[model samples]
Target: MPKNVKPVYYGDYLQLDKLLDSQQPHSKQYGPEAHDEMLFIIVHQVYELWFKQVLHELRAIYKEFCAEQLDDRALQLVAHRLRRVLTIQDLMNDQVGVIETMTPQEFLEFRDYLVPASGFQSIQFKELEIILGLTRDTRIAFDQQSFYNRLSEEHRVYLEELETHPSLFDCVDQWLARMPFLQFDDFSFWDVYQQAVQNSLDRDEEIIRQNAADDGQLETELASLQVNRDNFSALFDNERYKSLQEDNRVRLSQRAMLSALFITQYREEPAFHLAHQVITSLAEMDEKLTIWRYKHAMMVQRMLGTKIGTGGSSGHDYLRRTTEQNRVFKDFFAMATYLLPKSALPELPSAVRQALGFYFRHDD
Candidate 1:
């Protein structure tokens, strides 16, 4: 550690003077100040600050994933940082309630003063989304243009350049695809896994058949079962899985999907523990962001019912749609649908189990 350089004052270190003075309500510029406008501005400013921290964490995580290999220590650090992001996200979600305290009538006082400056112009938030892999194609129709169109030319150019780089989702896919345990000599894990899945599916079908009281009900249950059967079939079939990817039913590459599924299934294994935690944390982060979006959309509705956003967006409607569609880690959540019970999972071969564990047997 370096010796003391200069005396650091609290306000000077945090720039509290600049921070405290930054909140200038637009309403105050034209007419009597809207009291609640300060709260609105501060709440969003806090959100941007939090967004900055999240981006900081994500850049570090992205650099780690960009490596050719992620060792256990690296994976642990990644999980820890991701959990930190999740914690911040929880705070962001809860902060919506603070803004909600400002009544709709109070919001109206300053709302018209802020023209052509909607939440859509939040460059940090958009950067966070792009870095996390919500590409143009993945966005909803209105959002595909609105997100970029609303940004200033400089911000648009910066984000476009950012899009050229691989996203966290892309890096994660590559990492999972490169996982070493997908292959072994004289052992076929997926073969055994397939048979177990088939057995489980057969059992489910039998139960459904027995429970059905009429032909129509039986047909309906069978149709649903067939969908599951097709999904499981796609899991092992590369071409079929690619078809699913084409249909946008899934996103991760087949190899990466399989690796993620394998890690999730045997998360108890020493090597898979941190890997599983990384996936779980990413999924939770997505959920928290979605929750924030939903809360924000509701807030927008309260403030501007059926009103177009200042940035010419559909306001709450657009936000609500984003909550459902604009997700980067939905594949992780959907992976749960394909997960089989631990009881149904085939016991890993001893050699493979040993490889996954920390300890090695020594022959004397």
Candidate 2:
């Protein structure tokens, strides 16, 4: 390390002069400045700053996953970084409350002054979505064009190029598909798992049949059970799984889905603990993001009622749709459906147990 260096001033080091000067309210540009506009601008600027930090963490995590192999230490680091992102998401969600402090009437004072500039033009937020794997095909129909149409040519081209790269979700799917635990000699883990699943489904069917009082009730119960049966059946059948994928019912590949399911079911195993944490963190991140979207939609409704967004979106209605559709980690959430109880899980063979455990042996 260098012993001597130029003295660092706080304002210059943090660039407070430029940062503090950046928030110029549109309302002020015209006439009387709306009081609440400052709060709105500052809150959104803070959000962009946080988005930059999240992208920093996500890029590092993506590099780790891009490696040919992720050792336990690398996996631990990935999980740690993901946890940090989750913490930031919690803060971002809570900050929505700060903006909510401004009443709808207050928002209306400056809202028209900033015509055609909506949250839809938030390029950093769009970058975050693209990096996390919300491709154009997966986005809500209006969103597929709305944001693109609103962006400048430079920003639009940048995001279009970004779409060509493998997102964090893509990297995760490939990594899970490569998991060595999915195979061991001629032993097939899924065969045992499928049998256990069948038994559980059978037990459920029996219970439903016994509980149904009349023919109409029995038919309805059976129809619901059939849907569950078909979902489970698709897990073990490649063609059926592919059909589901084609219909967009699932996104992760068959091998990756199975590997994720295995890790989730036997998360207590020493080998799977870190992987489990990664999946859990991703699911929580997805949930937090959804909560943020929902909150934003509610806020929009409170402010604009049924009005169209300044950027030409259907406003609250469009945002509400995105809450349901613009998800990158839904596969992780859906994986829970395929998990069997620990009690129902087959006891691992001795060799498999040794392979999964972190034990040391020595000659007496």
Candidate 3:
């Protein structure tokens, strides 16, 4: 059967090659302890690979968006990509749930062997943060302060090269500006917004597009975004605007549109609301991932309490900082409670403060 028909070589060369040899333990120390460490290492490596794919798709999706390639597919691709990310995140979350079962003294023996091998050096993780609309302005970027200094030059350069263009959210705004939908309803407004987003995506896949990835250009081309200053103010308060515009210098769009998206209430154009939804969803994903880090930290701390990390970090405290600082989409969380109805917004005081943690929403 094989000679007559050339067998289908079902091998994905790049993937198989990378996946098979990806997990490299720091030492020859192989025991039952290595079992959990291997589990720890393999899970993260696999997820980073997946994170790479997310960045690839995000860049492509963003490019299509900038070209004014409005359609429902554009919006859908994001959910598709993100759903996969969330699925893996859920898997990672479960992995954390499992790892958390380990005791502290058990973690101490080999923790020292892990010198400079912290997840903080994960290049792909940093890229994921950047693509999701986080920037260097946040505390995470300057984090080459500790074991993070262990980041390979390759990781550093890759991040430095990232276009930092208008993100998936910016693309959504460009799509929303195309139609005359007054509100975030299920009929014309929602349909147009949905279709326009998808249309933008399909247009990208089916056709050759341009370098519309940069927000500076996309904003100019799709300049008629209806959500404005007064509209933004009316739907939400001013601090809401500031919370959303944490990285005011990135210049994804004019501050008006950016803040309007994060802070403003749902006034017809679901600018703030959609941004709020995506931001919150992404933030949830980020929070889930932090669970993994904290679990890792706890393992290290329990095993080698108040000791140094294998990756040359301050161990528990270092990881605590990571868990606190690793938010890829901070504004989304900082402004989450505001996504609820005004009445509901008031009830969640902690969420309210977190959302307003970044900035004031007022204009002038």
> Tens digits of per-residue lDDT for model 3 on 1-364?
4465544454663567767787766544554454455655666676676677767766765675576443344444555655666777777557655655655644454555666566667777766666665545555433644423676777666677773565555554454444332332223333333344344444543332254567675565444322332223422344654454553422222333434332444433332333344444555667777786777677666766787666656768877777877555444443332233433221223433333422222212
Model 3 stretches astray by more than 4 angstroms: 1-5, 9-26, 29-37, 101-106, 140-148, 163-280, 290-300, 328-364
In terms of lDDT, model 2 sits at: 0.89
Q: Can you list the residue pairs that collide in candidate 1?
A: none
Candidates sorted by TM-score, best first: 1, 2, 3
How big is the positional error of residue 163 in model 3, measured in Å on the Cα after superposition? Answer: 6.1
Best by TM-score: 1
Instruction: Evaluate model 2: give its TM-score.
Output: 0.95
Residue pairs whose backbone atoms clash in candidate 2? none
TM-scores, one per candidate: 0.96, 0.95, 0.58
Tens digits of per-residue lDDT for model 1 on 279-339? 9999999999999999989989988899998889889999999999988989999888789
What value does the lDDT take at residue 305 in candidate 2?
96
Q: Residue 115 of model 1: what lDDT?
A: 88
Off by over 4 Å in 1: 357-364
Q: How many residue pairs clash in each candidate?
A: 0, 0, 37
